[model samples]
Target: MAEWALIFKTAIALFAIVNPIGVIPIFISATDGWPAKDRAHTANTVAITVFIVLTVSALLGESILEFFSISIPSFQVGGGILVMLIAISMMHGKQSTTRQTPEEAQETAERNVIAVVPLSIPLLAGPGAISSMIITAQQSGSFWGHISLALPIAVVCLAIWLALRLSMHIAQRLGTIGINVVTRLMGLILAAMAVEFIAHGISGLFPSLAS
Candidate 1:
């Protein structure tokens, strides 16, 4: 039961952070004028790319931290700050430069293949998302626990694909204001999660504070 609860929490956290609905406008614009088949293909490619990136992060992130002699607590704090910045940006209905800078966005515009570059890499599976998965992976502790993280990643990626596949209908139904409202709501949830991450990291770093 506890494991299931954790999985549910993981799903919610990933969904809030990824915020596929929030990215609908960007996806629509990027795939504009492409045939429906090509747009669908792009969405699938993005989903697969994100899933692979995040799953790898969840599996190998701890090792990478160890290689650098960085402790999980330190990573948690840093990742928390990054996530908080993204949350703040989402609240303002803007993409974080952390995810993709102006240059990257411009490059994405000029590029022919965007599914793997800006869309999948930074736009969706950005540093914040990667770090969050790493933190969660460390917390999971067991081999099975680490593997289970993939379930939520798959779910979030699926949501991303669906959102992109139906981008036009969603845009028509929700409009810009509606999308912004949802983004702000997701941002609020993400902010609370970020605080929790920071607090937990601090407690881990200073055991005395946990008492």
Candidate 2:
């Protein structure tokens, strides 16, 4: 049915926005010293955090923005800057530097917060996702429209879970080179998304700019 197609489109849009593949390097960095037994736990924790943040944001971020008199254009500009910086870092093969600052000669690795930081915030529920969800919801005034958008959010989280769960297998098969390739490719995608956000902001800022 038409409704199913809408859901599929929403899922793809969310998938592009979430891009689990983009977060792999960050995940590896976070779990660098974690025991093998704990890797799954860490990934699950990260995935769960992402799910919670994104789901909440999807449901209420718009309300919060409206209540605060915040503009999506402002978020578009700020979020675009953040995503572009992260994308550039990923593209240059330095994801560790992209999100968290290094521990700096090992006083003690700040590994505990990795799941919540780069993994959960920008990686999953960052500005791009939050903005996209708000826009999608507004566009989705009807019941089916809401369902369409919600399906994608759920699917994106599911993809994250699967990716993190299979991280070991993925790393083994891909090797560093493969992971690098995937990282850069995802970076390119992220870069494009960032451009869209910036454009959205700028367009809003100057109605006649791009026109």
Cα lDDT tens digits for candidate 2, 1-211: 8767756755765665566765666577667778877877777787788777766666676678889998877766776777777678768765534343445314224445666665776556766667667655644567556545656676788899888878767777887888778777767776886787688888888889978
lDDT of 1 by residue, 97-165 (tens): 899888877777787778998889898999989999999999888999999999999999999999999
Best model number under TM-score: 1
What is candidate 1's TM-score against the reference? 0.97
Listed in order, each prediction's TM-score against the native is 0.97, 0.72
Cα shift from native, residue 122, model 2 (Å) = 5.6
Question: Lowest summed lDDT over 10 consecutive residues: which window, candidate 1?
Answer: 104-113
Residue 178 in candidate 1 has what lDDT?
Answer: 99
Candidate lDDT values, in order: 0.93, 0.69
Model 2 misplaced stretches (Cα beyond 4 Å) = 1-19, 22-38, 96-98, 101-147
In every candidate, how many clashes are there? 0, 0
Rate residue 82 of model 1 by lDDT.
Answer: 97
